[model samples]
Target: MPSNVPTFTDLLAGAKRSAVHLEMRDTYYSNPRFESWRQGHCVDWNDRASWWRPFHQEIADAVARGVTVRRARVVSEPVTEYIRWEHYVTHANVTAGEQVRWLPRRLASDLLLPGNDFWVFDDTSVEIHHFSGDGDSIEDEILSDPKLIELCASGFERIWERAIPHEQYEIH
Candidate 1:
């Protein structure tokens, strides 16, 4: 990404209307949180203090300011263990006021998707995330080109429309 581009934190902090994220990978083994979960560290749902992370706090703060936040995940059916854990702990996202949904990959077969995962802020900018085959983050690029932004924003909506809300989606 160019040095002039604002970080996702900055962009989200400044978002006035909406912010949306789309995650399509089923496994992100390199994520420390995922690794911890894989090693038996689980969120104590009864204890908010134990699992309230900064990322969740960011979303919460944004929501408090009236910035609508949404997230959609496109996953393969018979989900990977990482996705199962993510589903188990998604309540934090809900508590943070993000509207999250899940779309089975099979259902998204006909939809055109971006080459990378992304976050669209206020429909004006996109932060595209690149990852390796094993799901390790490689880099992020922020783009404000109208065409790219439109593609991501529209694609997110289509997936969101077909997705099952977090509360309604069951792990297969």
Candidate 2:
């Protein structure tokens, strides 16, 4: 996280039409929440107060503003332990108004995807996330080049079309 680069909340708040995310990695080493889940911490879905957080509130707020927030994940199957943990907690994302989908890597073999994960905002700008080989997030680069934005935005839509909605997708 850098001072110059806008945070997710900032980007979402500024988004007018749509905010889409594409995640291709099966693991993220920097996430403490995943660590908690690995240690046996489970989200009590019945109790909203237990798992709800500011991030969800951001998505809810953005959706309330008519922003179509969607996330599509391209995972390898038999999924990694981290992907299983991600699946366990995806309800929060759905509850927050994000339309989530999953596409197995095997099913995406024919598609040309982006080299990095990204968030395309309003089809005008893109936030490309960079990660280390060990799955630790390194930095994010925001680009507004028309060609690059178009490429990423279109790439996301292609994956979205092939991905199964979270409600229907069963972890393998």
Candidate 3:
């Protein structure tokens, strides 16, 4: 694996058409924000300053430049506590002009999902992320292979089609 892989911002920064992210984890091991939420620290969306982060602003800026950003999360039906908390913070994503959707794992049973989560940029390249059993991000691989890109993009489209929009999805 090459150590010069592009970060999410790196990929998005060069995206001219679209950016789609696919997330398939129920819980992540090394996410500080998730840990904070797990420990009862919720983002007060009402407070404008509290929820504004550099990453969110980056998404907003991308949208402003007409780059369509979309995210799809395939989660368990009986949502995990972490998923529930994630749902609450999704407001920031929407505010950043990124489209988000949630699909229950049951609904994805027939789908050919990827083994790892990924972000596809303009259907040209993919940032495939590897996670440990405990959900720690182990590594991210960037690929420009046609077959891999096709699989990831098509998989994301399938999930997005069956997922409920953020505004309509209710946590379990």
Candidate 4:
């Protein structure tokens, strides 16, 4: 028998309007869902070295549209590699008008705290009960919280500040 699994769309039907806050460990961005979201211009986070390709493409897209994309890392190596490989070597076809930013890992954590209003911890083991009082139902709580929207916007700003300018990185 096929088990009834709830998909994001199902959850979204009942979810509130607040912007989502997704938290994942290093490298979750490699998931196909992340790639789809990137292609659609949605924001995401991951701290792994292997995500350079998708990350580069996402950033390049954001830049070309004259949108600012920000990121943060707890460590420097991944960022450095991203700079060298994606920015320097491939010289991915990014537009001159786009802007990118990065932030230290500590700051990334600060923006993800409890008081931020609505948050979405995207992973396999999260249960609806765990988020009961901590925030709102992915289906219902966010629809009413304006604060959550602001918090997400603020988080994006921090990432923007720390990111390196594309041209400065030596695109190969």
Candidate 5:
């Protein structure tokens, strides 16, 4: 697959099963569309300053609607800002019981934590090509060539195997 080619959506829809590979980059929620998606039942790999409120809202909404949300973090600068806002503006709904897989940073640690949900691979450094609808060529491109998805899924599994279970995480 060409690096410049777009295949994410087709890969997602074509996926009989899917694993999401994500990274926590800065400025993720600024996009309106991304915000709308965040409003739905989704999992994120985020270590941003402004992510918690929306994240909390999304988690609460998902839980209310009977959806499971999981998260993972690997030591980005501590979310001091998010913590302050969370403490002052909203009551914390994410309790210690909620499972969040934590991993070390040699590999893609963030991607490993959230399993079975849509992988929001935050490769913000690279230009992400998005595909829409059932374009025959695009479907053929991803289905016939499963390398992209396989590589992503394998990466997630590898890190997942080595990660610490979020059950042990202390809520502060």
Candidate 6:
């Protein structure tokens, strides 16, 4: 990303309508949060202030403004350890005012999904994240192309429609 490129926080903070994220990876080790998850077994879901902090605070602020923040994940059955870890920590996401859902890969087979993970903000701008085979984020790029934005928005909705809400999905 260039110096002028806006951060994900900046994108969310600027959203005037809905902000949606689609995650396709089953394992992510690049986040240091995973380290804590690995050692502690779970995120401190009850410690609202200490646990979520500014990141969740940012999403809360957006929700306060009526920006419907949602995240949809597509994972395989017999979920990976990292995914189980994510399933456990996601309660914080719901508590912070974002809606989250999970789509089993088997259930999403026919959907024409994007090849990358992305965040589409306000149905306008899109940020695509590229990760290496090991699941480390190698690069991310922001796109203003109307076609790409529409594609991402539609793809997210397709997955969202098929996914089970966080409260309903059981980790495999």
TM-score of each: 0.94, 0.95, 0.93, 0.33, 0.35, 0.94
lDDT of each: 0.92, 0.93, 0.91, 0.35, 0.38, 0.90
- The digit string of per-residue lDDT tens for model 5 on 1-172 reads 6765545543333333222333333122234534454465333435434445554554455455444434444433343333223222222334411234545454453453332222432312111223333211222232222444455446555665765665453334
Task: Show pairs that collide, candidate 2.
Answer: none
lDDT of 3 by residue, 1-172 (tens): 5547677788888889899999999987747787787788878778979879999988998899899999999999799877887899889999999999999999999999988899999999999989899887888888999999999999999999999999999888
Candidate 6's residue-wise lDDT over 1-172, tens digit each?
Answer: 6779999999999999999999999887556777777787555556666677688889999999999999999999999988988898887788889999999999998999999999999888999999998888888899999999999999999999989999999988
Query: How far out, in Å, is residue 29 in model 6?
Result: 2.1
Please list the residue runs of candidate 1 whose C-alpha ends up more than 4 Å from where it truly belongs after superposition: 1-3
Between candidates 5 and 6, the TM-score winner: 6
Candidate 3 — worst ten consecutive residues by lDDT sum?
Answer: 1-10
Top-lDDT structure, candidate number: 2
Clashes of each: 0, 0, 0, 16, 1, 0
Alpha carbon deviation, residue 166, candidate 5 (Å):
1.9
Model 2 lDDT, residue 158, Cα:
92
RMSD of each: 1.4, 1.3, 1.7, 11.9, 11.9, 1.4
Local distance difference test, candidate 4: 0.35
